[model samples]
Target: MPSTWTTTPVTAGLVHGALELEHTANGILPHRLPARARAQNTDGQLAMAESQPSGVRLVFRTRATAVELDTLPTKRIYVGAPPRPDGLYDLLVDGHPAGQAVATGGNTLTIDMSTGTVEHGTGPVATLRFTGLSGEDKTVEIWLPHNETTELVALRTDAPVEPAPASGRRTWLHHGSSISHGSDAASPTGTWPARAAALGGVDLVNLGFGGSALLDPFVARAIRDTPADLISVKIGINLVNADLMRLRAFAPAVHGFLDTVRDGHPTTPLLVVSPILCPLHEDTPGPTAYDFSHLAEGRLLFTATGDPEERAAGKLTLGVIRDELRRIVTRRAADDPNLHQLDGRDLYGEPDHAELPLPDRLHPDAATHRRIGERFAAHAFTAGGPFGDGTG
Candidate 1:
């Protein structure tokens, strides 16, 4: 710890990236969804993703040379996998990537899907520290691990830390699946949404929930209530993978989702993006299943297990979802000029996929993330684009 440093509580007002904070006896746990919104959540997948804090960060102003955070992370471990990687904490000074960290100790949750059981292992909290910060008062953003569930205990700094002044940048609120949550991105800033936020010159509030982007009403409510100059929803991928709804339920669901968001952000630029090219699920319906064929080789893969014929019964594939989304957006745009649609393939298509195939047969690699972010900024935010100021 820095000599004679002051400590600060991890309060709701201090955290920028998280939607809500779960104040516990040990520390404050950041939640991507608020209590009212989370109350409707029953799916374990959504529950897990909400607690991961992908784009959530702690933003404050400080002149400290050194800072430390006591955190207890709930790290998940699959029963058969060798071991998961440590979650990273990416730090930014005045919006520039500066440092990175990883907490050491916390409770470990092990799960064996084959047995449908979970084992919780308790451990001590670990303090992550960073030093040599520039002396000038500067805005600092501590991006939490995108893949880990972290409980922030306390913050210590050589100098007092206060909420960072708003950048006065337009807030871009984005919602998507795992790709948007940064499944394979190198760091928090490396995520496509973060990269796009940088390129688009906007503030980011990423609501990208991994497997939870199933067009849930609560998610739509959250998006509707949040203040955003520009709003985007990267739909379809999670829908196809989860096979949560069929054609009949999907169209109405999409309509309802957008309607709910429009209730609050009637005029905000809303971009509805389809799924990126995932050949595995383009034609095949899914409830994507794990392919442990080469477990010994330490290579895990996923496959769409649902039959293509199921589409006739209203089962959704990426292609089906994309077509439906386009139809819905075009129809809606006829009435609402603020609504727009962007094909996900434009960001990551055939050529890009060949060079940077989704390493997991799902999530794009880190480099691919950069490509997506850059493309998104060009397609959505640049002049003459859907979200360009000229549109208004």
Candidate 2:
């Protein structure tokens, strides 16, 4: 006779790195942003990004030889773009990579990038099973897909389970754009922020919303209220690509954001990172658009549509944003010693770009993600760095 499976309720205590949990019709959906912050905005992009659960995971301890998870994933589909693979669920045992699985059935979110139109199609839940595990008590983590919105339906194991005890690691809360949201990275743990967190021996709370990190007031408030031992904000790329603010508005907005974060965490080690090297937007302004030129070939690429000549008029570009960010951090750091600034180029600069270019002319590929993660760990977590040892 087969061993009877024990079903466990997925609850808040069993989940890690999520700020909120919403009870859906089928199951629980983890959210990176709290309900209050989400209530303030109605942008579809932000909504989808937050629901994706970039750095969220299920954590427990058990002696089960086999484990199973039932999930309903809302997969994204671009009408004309190449087909995307099914979302991945990564399993870790005792802090080591154990296995990886993909849930089969789920809803589909069809997006027409050209017209900014979206359509939804419903599907059934998928049960992902992993067997052959060691039957000794050990910590287990099931990292949710970084790019897909997943509703965790149920968890089943051959043995009873309990929430894993705290690891006592420092919590690092990070906010950034799609790149930090694991846009092109292979898995949730593969995101640069995730990789860096692992290398730095810290817990991660990622607030990286794709194409939506516009320094919104609600986001700042969300950051302000969240508890974190270390904090970092990656700004500039989205601001430039979205063409959201001018130089005059940009400086004040950044200051206000930092001010909001400091409201809750006055002495936290906070690092302000500029955008990494993006040659397309380095000199040219944006309102980036899809290059439909190769649509016939099933290739979708992004291109800057803003006129380079608009720089004189104060249209934002990567170059312009970087300069202003350095100046702002310099002046602010004089009065606030805990605050620090790092050039985005230092992470993935001109030399790094020549080696590993962004796949879509905007987002970095998986290899570049690793490189950026390694470099970030070296910079921010080492001695003399903002979040380094001996720093408050």
Candidate 1 structure, TM-score to reference: 0.97
lDDT of 1 at 60: 93
Clashes of 2: 0
The TM-score values for the models, in the order shown, are: 0.97, 0.98
Per candidate, the number of residue pairs that clash is: 0, 0
Check candidate 1 and list the clashing pairs. none
Please provide, for model 1 over 187-273, each residue's C-alpha lDDT reduced to its tens digit, 9 standing for 90 to 100. Answer: 888999999988888878889988879999999999888888999999988888877888999999999999999999998889999
Candidate 1 Cα deviation (angstroms), residue 92: 0.9
| Stretches of model 1 off by over 4 angstroms after superposition | 390-392
Q: Where in model 2 is the C-alpha error above 4 Å?
A: 390-392
Each candidate's lDDT (Cα)?
0.89, 0.92
Clash number for candidate 1: 0
As for candidate 2, its clashing pairs are: none
The candidate scoring highest on lDDT is 2
